[model samples]
Target: MVLNVDNYHLKSLDNLDVKCDITKVRTEVIFRQSNEKIGHGIIIQSKHFDRVAVFAPFSGIIINRIYSVYVERIPRDQQWNEQESGTYWFVPSNQIPELVPISKYSANDRELIGPLVGVVVSKAIRFAFVWSPSLGEGICENHENLVIGGWIKFMAE
Candidate 1:
């Protein structure tokens, strides 16, 4: 339950801003981490009550690996309206709020730190998406399919 991504980069709000430099995304929860590049494992589920979510990658569309992610709903309490605490507010994936994958974790039980999707945008907001599962439907550009920059975890109450 540790996904502390906040290297604070910017630019994302409506023109589907495509800048780039999401701190060089390379997951494994940020390559076994040492200092920054936060992210430990992933988990998601709400009504059934399993929570631990984090996937804060954003850069418009990192080459179809579907970059723009900002799904956050952790041990936070409240903050969701003009939210800008540590900053990271890209938005457009249809205002992202619909994901579901229940379980899957690994640190070395067999080299598996992928699959961990999520959703539960209510009990204080919860949204998720952990990638690098070989980028199957990771993401691509958008027009009608909707993937066009996203960010939506706000907590501070």
Candidate 2:
């Protein structure tokens, strides 16, 4: 759980209702199924998010962006630190393929965006992605969960 210490309150994301369809639908129907190509991912935030690509839910390798979000902070340190930080991931929209408008979301919605990486040590979340030898990866609705080591990726490697 690379949750922001000072930014992104979890409640802002929990049960965040976005108008997915113009008409209303059951909550169970919306998230119960994996909605095809729209997989989930963790939101990695900074004072500024750079070189980030915002793909259209359908197109790929698009040079231009449909939308972009930028935040500023002390220079970003892409290095792998010994301390356990949060893992980062990208949630792709299955139907659109390349279209994922994370930037279009308000700060609260962005906070809800996170990769289902192993376990989240923070208290704000309930769902987590746990690792297993047989299952590879699975979701567990538990907070303060820790992800097993040796599964995450860093730019250094």
Candidate 3:
């Protein structure tokens, strides 16, 4: 399914409910003027998963607006160095056409948000995403009772 931000209010993370419909996620979108368009560094934080930051150049994103969430399958050839700090990946402004959407979420409904389903190991690193009916979603670092197809990254904290 295609998600368009125009349907939702472009509000900042501070204006949304942290624990209700939006769940455990908190966001920050830092915009810069690029050729008369708005580019952004989008940070999505949740006590349950690893912190994810995405940069979109000339993305036309407005600060403090709520956008839908879509998780796309990362390309196997994509260079993601887990051992390195300050690493980033870039996607075109029209991400829907370029990447395969594996999951989609609407921030306005807690019921639609996906649960942590499973874990995967890349380069000997374990990643986990967890979800609970009562506790919501979280990242699981260590291998525990994992099934398959979950969300978030497990951290060592």
Candidate 4:
């Protein structure tokens, strides 16, 4: 199955309000395409997933992610009321750009044109740092240990 992530949206009764821009818009998943000046955005592997999940890089202490996929460094950990809606983070299969590996959480990111970011979806095996709901409705995934203004990486499983 293909992970079409643009159709996703995230909205909360609290302070979380995000929208998925990869499932439909055919986004351009980019990383450090150029401008080596900015670090912590070295995004690579765009063609690996059809849809990408993007969450708010909100400020906090408990940075959560889906394992090797995304990383964030927060300052504190507070119990959120739970997001009402979840958004998508992805690029078009033709817009999937290149990602340069420069450290990890310090690189440049931008938009480019390429193929749709494709991710393999399987109902057989599960992956580490990744989870899919039994109903495939809500997301029950997050990365632990992170700081503020940090970077996150979510790979295709």
lDDT leader: 3
Task: Give, for candidate 2, the lowest lDDT window spanning 10 residues.
Answer: 23-32
Angstrom error at residue 41, model 3: 7.6
In TM-score terms, which candidate is top? 3
lDDT by residue (tens digit), candidate 1, 1-157:
2222222222245412333413221122221122222233223222211222334332332221212223322323334321222222122223333222223433232323333331111221232232212221122121221222332222211
Estimate candidate 3's alpha-carbon lDDT, on a 0 to 1 scale: 0.31
Candidate 3 lDDT over residue span 96-123, tens digit each: 2122122443343233333332122111
Mark the 10 consecutive residues where model 4 has the least summed lDDT.
66-75
The estimated TM-scores of all candidates read 0.17, 0.21, 0.29, 0.18
Off by over 4 Å in 2: 1-8, 14-57, 60-62, 66-87, 97-157
Cα lDDT tens digits for candidate 2, 1-157:
2222122123222222223211110111011122223222222221112111112333342322222222111112534321232322222333332223546544343333333222121222654443321222345444342332212221110
C-alpha lDDT of all candidate models, in order: 0.25, 0.25, 0.31, 0.24
Weakest lDDT window of 10 consecutive positions for candidate 3:
1-10
Candidate 1 global Cα RMSD: 17.4
Instruction: Compare candidates 2 and 3 on TM-score and give the better one.
Output: 3
